[model samples]
Target: MNRDDGPLFGGRAWLPALLIVPMFLGFAFLGVQGGTVIGTLTLAAVVVWAIRANPEGPIEIAAPGEGVRGGVLVVLLAPIDDPPVAGVLAAITDPSRREAGEPLLLAPTRIGRLDRFFGDIEAARFESQRVLAVSVATLAAAGIEVEGRVGDDDVVLAAEDTLRTYAATEVVVFAPGEDDDGAIAKLERRLGIPLRRID
Candidate 1:
């Protein structure tokens, strides 16, 4: 339906009556006795004011699909770093120079933390949850609230289809460097919607 169809009132028309009662109280306080000229005028003024104030109803957020209005969705991607920390360090002999060599594979942070806490099923899930929490925290710190819709998952062609199905107005993607570039290209090709990368 078009916006001109009076906004799908859904019982909002009674709002004016609600305001008129308050106006009557205000009029009584103003020494306008028993709903007379001044009292009636006050009530009319309030009703008009109330009618003009159009408040919107809340919309629900759901998975992307056809016939549903999708909202802005943000997806964050974190890739593993190469030669992670805690690697081997080569030191010098007493009189010689120090030589640096290949890093010893450090115990994975996700593994260490996961073993310390969740006791294992999938370490990847643990890391994903950790990253999602971090992403939310970072976004909030930067004054960007994820009020509309936000999700975390492996973004693929199906993900793009889901986004289009839900008819999202805005899609926020969090990919770093080359990953972000790749995501944008894929989204552009598949959804034909503009992809905005957040630093």
Candidate 2:
């Protein structure tokens, strides 16, 4: 969902009406048959529209407080933009990393979509950056030592790049959904580092 998309059907109140009009007209014309076809088409249209319109689901990540230095790397996924996730950021981050004024790098990855083709790349990338920016700000406000944050569309590529760039002792993943496990596991195997998730 791009910032330009304007808040989930924002100004487009007529879309549902547009769908309903045909069904009503069909019912008036050919009685049951026409109404059924239009009704089916309308249902399909609504499903497609909903899939395209709705935003990503929330992924909540929280962990108990642990104090350590700058040896842990954090990779954030969706729902990190939510303010409540900030407490998790504070928990996983090492207070010493902030106290020593060290710049902790947090990589935010937005999953790519098969629906977004070449022409749609710019808008998609912009939306991804927008989401990542919010997550970064949320983490920063929690006093996490995130000096700089990186954004990527592919989760595995981002994890590989993060591992290559940072000499982190361990890894923490902030993903809170069952469907994400396979992707997270792929990253874990590629990095060859133990990836801990907040249950």
Candidate 3:
């Protein structure tokens, strides 16, 4: 099938489509409009699913005093350990910007079933959050004051949201050393800001 003809449902559309076979068989046994009802409901469901699967528009965040603190938005991906806090801090041009405190936003993408079919999605999400929490504590122990928030896995959106919310004048993306440079570059372009990286 062409990309345009692909199912609109998120995840596996094949699962639901397979159910149609059993549904038809069962509905036939029930007699009368039962089969028709089942078919209608299934078709309606697919339509609704397609509509919802469409990507949402960009989000906007509001901050007080127009980010008077001169905050820096940090978007950290998973496996964040010993995050070069000092180096990151020293890289900032002005000491005054640090006064308001840098806000670290962890936005780890969930491992999809394609990557690990037997793994639990919730477990993956929680693990990412846990990693972010540990990174936050590590930074705090290093005497680098930071405010933290766990955000969506989409780095582009996460960076944008954090920057607006924190009123950050600059952005730093802490990604795994092995991550795709192309993706990182794309994210920077989307944010309209050249992201400083530490990894």
Candidate 4:
């Protein structure tokens, strides 16, 4: 599994020991003054390391090569009862597209800060399901057969998760407009597969 996909200290069991062993030895043998100095320096170094490491950095998505099957993963930002934009539909329906497993339509739960803080995700989940239902129906009407799923709140994370289970040849994202968070650019860089954005 990718390091980015794991928990912060998941595989690296030595990290805690490496960090604490020296401090413990210093405090035991060097007395209070030296131990205080060592502890302060260690704390500073840890802060610097965390900053440089950027744990929330971009997730690495493997490109779907010949080993993987072909299909499309459509990420919907909103309910789409109407037909999707031309670019999106064309990418999904293009005859020249590589064949793969069944297509999937994914909608990420969009929960507000306050609602999430209060653990009130029911509304968000409901909204995501609604998006999937409407989008699936719309795509079905267009003669495209695709399964639907609700994913994580973070769009990029949701795509990454879906890609793990579904080896989609291409990913098409439908957003109302350009997002201030630069989600499209991140997806283009990290998805590895061909990414199409319709706004």
Q: Whose TM-score is greatest here?
A: 4
Local distance difference test, each candidate: 0.42, 0.59, 0.60, 0.75
Which candidate, 2 or 3, would have the higher lDDT against the true structure?
Answer: 3
Minimum summed lDDT over a 10-residue window in model 3 is located at 55-64
Candidate 4, 111-181: lDDT as tens digits: 89999999999999999999999887777777777778999998888887877767777788888866867
Best by lDDT: 4
Assess every candidate by TM-score: 0.36, 0.51, 0.56, 0.75
TM-score ranking from best to worst?
A: 4, 3, 2, 1
Predicted candidate 3 versus true structure: per-residue lDDT over 1-199, tens digit per residue: 3444444543454666685874587587865577777777777876787677744333333454843443566667654456465445445523465433455555555566564676556776777778777776766665666656666556666665566656555567676566653656766655543467777
The sequence of per-residue lDDT tens digits that candidate 2 reaches over residues 1-72 is 354445456667665567788899889997999899988988897788777874332221222134422356
lDDT of candidate 4 vs native?
0.75
lDDT of 1: 0.42
Q: Which pairs clash in the backbone of model 2? A: none
Residue 41, candidate 1: C-alpha displacement in angstroms: 89
Over 4 Å off in model 2, which ranges?
1-70, 82-84, 97-116
Candidate 2 weakest ten by summed lDDT? 56-65
Q: Candidate 2 overall Cα lDDT vs. reference?
A: 0.59
